[model samples]
Target: MFTPILAISASLNDSQRIHALKVGANDFINKPFIEAELAARIKNMLLTQQLYQQIAMQKEALEKMAMTDQLTGLYNRHFLMPYVEKALSSAQRYNYPLSIVMIDLDKFKLINDDLGHDAGDKLLCGIAHILENNCRSEDAAIRLGGDEFLVVLPHCSLEQAKFKTETLRQAITELPPASHKTSASFGLSSTEEGNFIFEQLFSMADSAAYQAKMNGGNDICH
Candidate 1:
């Protein structure tokens, strides 16, 4: 909400009116102003403020849409780089641990082929919900396109990350029968002091995830 400013003056002059506007006045009225005119000015100022607020809200909504995945209602790849950069900077400055977990649904295409794209979408949303429920409020769960997802855990050690991923893996395995026996492979990377670059860390996690898939999906590798 915005506060409307109405500048009232005894002796109105061009210089005084300009000064009032410069000082954040929405409208200026002389001492002997008519009550109807003052009321009209107040009404206009309120309407203008309402319009400004609406514009700000709309801009915020658009920005959120740009960074969110429409399918799963999770953060999309567009939000990943900036978030990683900021989290990494904070981790380095504070000398804390940060972890990244890469998740890929096992045999996802088979599900799509067998059940249909709608079923595939349902499973993805289900998995995203599980991820959201399992993570801390400060953590980020992201959909990195297709059947791939990533979790960012700030202030988490490598061992802790592995434990969490294992729990999540089990959760996916135990999903409702409607999910058609879903499973996933998890690859984890962590830095205790934020010494590694984002690319390096992400590559390590991705390779680990690939290895997990190779070892027979539904596994975790770090």
Candidate 2:
């Protein structure tokens, strides 16, 4: 929602905007408004409205395209980095704690092979739903393609992260989709890797993800 913007005429030989600002206007335009000036102001207002509208639309769109997994409607890796980077920076700056949990489907290959891709897709979507519902609104779950999902907890400890992951695991199992046939493994890391370049941060989290997959598929390894 764009804040209301105001514009006034400069008839008093002063940029009435200064006074108008005090009169409940967010941003103001000057006086002695010529037709062109009026046109420009109105144009600007309309343009601003349009610009703001475009910005709003873009924001909504970006939220969907950048964050959401197209198929599962879960947050995607593209959005994860920016969100995590910001969280990491803020956490470090404020002496707060931040952690990441990477999840991967266990026996995924067998499931895809036996159930077919459609079923596999359904499982992925179901998994995403379970993870999202199991998390706090502030917490985010993202898909890094395939059967992998990463959850970033900005102010959470390893214990909180573990509890959350367990919640998701239980949810996925307890409320399995129609076939009742998918399971996941998780790996968590909460060590403070300070001032990492973006790529390094991702690489670190990614390495943790790989570890989750390799060391016995269904438990959290931090």
Candidate 3:
């Protein structure tokens, strides 16, 4: 609801009042009405508008909380699948490539063990900031729980994804070093076909990420 609407007219017939009410009039005033009454109604309408704006802002904040990671302030796993599906559908419909990149911190457990959980969290948040800065407005950065992250690139090719992940890898290396040092591995997969399955793309990326880790981390595999 927005500002409360008012109907000011000389008509006082029952039908006229009913019509006003049905048309969403919150208050009605007749011609030659008392100035005090008009002023009071105006004040009430202004108050109602303020309340409506407050409620709208609260609702927006709640929705953002539901979709975002509390620690990194990035999109959480809950937002990934749905958002990817929508982006993928649009990409497929338009015959454009869509890519997914899987990222995992290398030797992350050592950070928590040697330093502290708080330090580990700080590192993650720092990396999240890099991702947010590197990605375009059309891209999404997701915290897929723990030290795992995902990046969805709409209308981006596999090669483009590789370049982006390489950039991110370089950025990660610039983060303050942990006692055991900090690094990450990346994997990418892309499709231009409308019939491609989301799970298949994700699995490909995951496997490639695993390969990168096995090959001694700090690199991208596709």
Best by lDDT: 1
Score each candidate by Cα lDDT: 0.91, 0.73, 0.90
Instruction: Please provide, for model 1 over 1-222, each residue's C-alpha lDDT reduced to its tens digit, 9 standing for 90 to 100.
Output: 677899998997999899889988989999998999999999999999999899989999999999999999999999999999999899888889999999999999998999889888988998999999999988999999999999999999999999999899999987754647789989999986446588988888899999999999999998
Sorted by TM-score (best first), the order is 1, 3, 2
Candidate 1 has what TM-score?
A: 0.95
Comparing 1 with 2 on lDDT, the higher-scoring candidate is 1
Q: For residue 114, what is the lDDT in candidate 1? A: 90
- Flag regions of model 2 displaced more than 4 Å: 1-59, 175-181, 192-215
Q: Tell me the TM-score of each prediction against the true structure.
A: 0.95, 0.69, 0.95
lDDT of 2 by residue, 120-146 (tens): 898888888787777787788888899
Worst 10 residues of 2 by lDDT: 193-202
Which candidate has the top score in TM-score? 1
Which ten residues in a row are the worst by lDDT in model 1?
173-182
lDDT of 1: 0.91
